[model samples]
Target: MEPFVLRGPEATLSTPTPADVDRVAEVCADPEIATWTTVPSPYSRADAEGFVTQMVADGWANDMMFTWAVRPPGEVDGPVLAMMGISRTVGAPGEDQAGEIGYWTAPDARGRGLTTAAARLAADWALDPEGLGLVRLQWQAYVGNWPSRRVAWKLGFRSEGTLRQFGLQRGVLRDSWMASLLPEDPREPVEPWPAEAPRP
Candidate 1:
């Protein structure tokens, strides 16, 4: 299947390429990724390349998941900054047509509110009838990853609940915060970008 590009207020989501492997490796080496994500502890260039070649390329070909690169607007002279993605269309047997979104920005790319904006865009697209008809969009982040939790909250995802020690990262089990938005929630108000949080 041909990869499709998705739009956001300030980012353009596209499929990853071999040329991006080096940039991905540079960003994955950041401590922030190690702190919040499941990236390898000693993340190396080879690991990034292998992942780009296998998990991203082969995975997309096999219909396991869809990946995208979050290119920042106005970046024209250097490495194209990117974010990793893994999502399946809703209702493919056990998936229930529910698309879950997740992302991480480069180190130098933090504090810009880009991820939050991009997430809202991605969610809107996923929920569109032409896209995935996703009845629910979910986000899960480690308890202490305030940045990610903040993005979810900013995008109108309510604090549904938490799963205690539901994930194992590195060598320890960690608690995860789970939040979601449903089609009938009426909480996702239709308005301008950065919509106000619906009153609970």
Candidate 2:
């Protein structure tokens, strides 16, 4: 498949390239990102290269996933602010197609809402009939990943409760909070903010 790009008001989503390996490694090496995401614990230049030159390429070639390197508009050649993607999910027979979303923001880029804006762009594109044509989008994160959960909630994904031992982070089983968004769901937050929720 040819590389595609999605431009939004605040960010641009484009295919990962070999040139991005160094910056990708730098971002993934942050302990906070490693702890919260599945990125390699001791992220190396080699890992970053493999992710861009192999994993990202293969996923796009096989139509199994679509990843975007997120950068601020007019900064496409600069360091990435985040990485976001949607992966195809197996559905029951006769069910509409579905995809799962995941993302991680650079430590230095936190608090700017870049990831949230990029996510909304990705989700909207995936749900478009002229685009991926997916019927629903799924989101899941380790139970305490309030930042990720907040992104999902802000995009109007219905909280679907928790899944016991649903994911493995750094080889350890962890519970996950799951959510889903359908084509008909409002794109803006529809419910009152929970007082106890942490700021994303």
Candidate 3:
């Protein structure tokens, strides 16, 4: 796997730096974090910084995937305000040519459509052959996480199915909604927004 670049309408994607862990930890500590993600409760700066180191090293040594900090557009020299990442493939080294998208926005950045725009930007890049050599992007969200699913649909992911007892979250087995965006249809009907359904 090779390094790739992805950019959002309001943010640019880059490997997360240690300095970014503080802000990222704050985002992870948001009350909304555990509601939608597998992120652990009581998120700490150590956990945050470790993720940066681990994710980057994994991307290179294990060819797992790349993670990036999403910084506000035109403000390229500060700590990232959010995070968005994509896996290189499903499980093994290489088989599916598909990637899983995940993201989180800072508490102060909520309601600004940051994550939505960032997700769209990631999908666009991953679907490009020059980028991840991906043919599809998969998104999964906990049931009732309308915000997350909305971003996926806005970015052209079709609700494909649901995974029952998929995994544990906050000590409970939960159902997850799954969706996909194919490379063939790269144009998102709606500009990335916080609410609404996928345009037919």
Candidate 4:
């Protein structure tokens, strides 16, 4: 798939490039991101380069994942505020069409609602017939990741309960919280925020 951009009033989402490696490496060093997401621990410049030249490349070339960096509008190679993507392995002849959303924010970018805005744009596009045409978009995070859970909820993903050792983060099995958003669901909170969620 050709690279594309998603623009919104607050941010512009664009594909990452080699020019972003320094900033990407710097941001991924945040302990919070390493703890909550699958980005490599002790992230390095090499890892950042691999992500852009490899994973990001393969993902788009194969149409299995569509990733975008959240940056201030028009600063394509500037410091990245956050990153997100929708991913899925397309299944056989009659299998269900589904994908999952994933994201992480630069530590300094937290509390700004940037990641939530990015997630909304990606989810809506993935579900629109004019976009990816997916029937379902799922959200999963290791248990205790309240911020991620809150973002999914804010985007109208119905809480689907927890699964034991359901996610692998850097190879270790971890319990996970799961939820899903159907194409027909309203793009607004459908359930009240859980008390455990961090207050805004």
Candidate closest to the true structure, highest TM-score? 4
What overall lDDT goes with each candidate model?
A: 0.72, 0.86, 0.74, 0.87
Better of 2 and 4 by TM-score: 4
Candidate 1 displacement at residue 115 in angstroms:
0.8
lDDT of 4 by residue, 105-194 (tens): 888888888888889989989989788878899999998898898789889999888999989998899999989999999988988757
lDDT string for model 3 (35-78, tens) is 77878788988888778777665774666677778887755545
lDDT of 2 by residue, 25-70 (tens): 9999998888788988899999999999999999999887899999
For candidate 1, the 10 contiguous residues with the lowest summed lDDT are 189-198
Worst 10 residues of 2 by lDDT: 191-200
Relative to the unseen true structure, what is the C-alpha lDDT of residue 107 in candidate 2, on a scale of 0 to 100? 85
The TM-score values for the models, in the order shown, are 0.83, 0.92, 0.84, 0.93
Count of clashing pairs, candidate 1: 4
TM-score of 4: 0.93
Model 4 spans > 4 angstroms off: 90-96, 193-195, 198-200
Query: What's the candidate order when arranged by decreasing TM-score?
Result: 4, 2, 3, 1
Where model 3 places Cα greater than 4 Å from the true spot, the runs are 1-5, 91-96, 189-200
So what's the TM-score on candidate 2? Answer: 0.92
